[model samples]
Target: MKAVRIHQYGSIDNAALEEIPAPKLGLDEVLVQVEAASINPLDTKLISGDMKDYFPLTMPYTVGTDLSGTVVEAGLLAARWKQGDRVIARLEPGSSLNKHRGGAFAEFVVVPAQLLTTAPTKLDLATSAGLPTAAGTAWQALFETAHLKPGQTVLVHAGAGGVGSFAVQLAKYIGAHVISTASAANADLVHSLGADQVIDYRTEDFSVALRDVDVVLDTVGGETLSKSYQVLKPGGFLISIVMPPDQEQAEAHDITATFFGHRSHAARLDLISGLCDAGKLRVIVDRTFHLSDMQDGLAHSASRRARGKILLRPAV
Candidate 1:
């Protein structure tokens, strides 16, 4: 099997495509003939050691997490899935519960069956590869954490990007007044995705233009995250996917602050897939690259300007 991997954490230049043996199946895992995988910011962060304190990597690590593929073999203990089943999964970063095992940027991958969910029936397996992490993160933050309600106003930063795109759509689906920040060029794109208002971040400061927001989803941390607190009304919420929110700022502003770390699980992926199949959700793919072009794909993801997910087809 051909896989893109890095011997050590450093840069995208360290990632290379090499032929390696197919992974061994675990008692509760399945072997998948990988069709496509999506490159995420987390992929680059993991490769560069930015997240080492949280998700320490094992040497010679494979470089992807989100994937859609067909099951070719199943372990004896993984009877829930079988050969020919099309599935989408987000492999979790190494934590105490799950060991580090990221090999999705490959021709074949062995994944714990518990992480696999049936691919959305309305989407092709290739497109479905973009759903697990991006959409799941938006779903978890809006519903699970903030509990955004209908008629409430929510502001999503980076509206044209992966998670932001989903957040705009889902917030609108839940009947919230969705406002999003995007460049002027992507204004129409974000509006079409359900943002009621698309603020041109380059032209206007969102904190000054909008106020009394019920929920602010901050994808751009640092200065932007700091300014987000000013837009929220008293008792509002600020949720960050990038880094932890400053507790002192939260108390001073009289708003709740939380940092969301996305969890990948079959059940959450299943719910997201159902929404996609029902036409309430959509996946926006920014670009697709072959395994040989792994560096270019990683570079694009690292740029952080993608409209949505960047996909990699391993079998290409």
Candidate 2:
């Protein structure tokens, strides 16, 4: 299979393409001919060795954690899936829980059957590839962790990026008035995605513009995450994805705080798929690249300013 691999982890410039051996099928694994995969910050961290403590990779490591593909073969233990079934999965990075090649940037990936979920009919398999990590992160943060309720108002940062786009739409679906921060260029785009109001972070101070939000979804950490508490209602929640929330600030503001790390669950993906099929959920794709163009796609994700999901098709 033609896949991108890091012979030595460093930067995107150091990655190279090679024909690697086909992955061995485990008893609970399914062989997927990956149609596409999307780059996330996690991929960048892994490649640069920033996450070595949690994801210790061997010298020659393949680096990708999301796959959208068709099942070319299934293990006997995977009775629910069969050859030619289209699916998507959120992989456990460098973890033993799944045998999926870090090679989602290649023509094939072997994911655990438990991680596989049927692809949404609303999106082609290629686009469906970007849904797992970004969408699931938004879902876990908003509904599972924050429990944002109807009639409440929520603030979502970087509304034009992967997770923020999903969070903007989901908050609207839940009947919450959604406000998002973005550049002036993305104002209309974020509004179209269901943001009740879009604040251009470059032009205005979001904290000065809004007060007493019911929930704040912080995709930008550091100072942005710190300032979020000032706008939340007392006892409101701050769900941070980029970094840990400031406990001292949260205490002073009388707001609850939690950092969300997305978990891969087929059941959760199914729910997202259902919403997409019903026309209630949508995937915003900023750009698409072939696996051969992996470097550019990854660099774009690292910018943290992409308009939407950046997809990489493997079988190019």
Give the per-residue lDDT of model 1 (tens digit) for 1-316.
8999999989899999999888888888889999899999999999999998978899899889999999999999999898999999988886333454677899998888888899998998999999988999999999999999999999999999999999999999989999999999999999999999999999999989999999999998988899999999999999999989999999999999999789886898899999999999999989999989989999998888899889999766
With a 3 Å backbone cut-off (N, CA, C), the pairs that clash in candidate 1 are none
Candidate 1 ranges with C-alpha deviation above 4 Å: 96-98
Question: What ranges in model 2 sit over 4 Å off?
Answer: 99-101
Structure candidate 2, residue pairs in collision: none
List the candidates' TM-scores in order.
Answer: 0.98, 0.97
lDDT score, candidate 2, position 118:
96
| Candidate lDDT values, in order | 0.91, 0.88
The backbone clash count of each candidate, in order, is 0, 0
TM-score of 2: 0.97
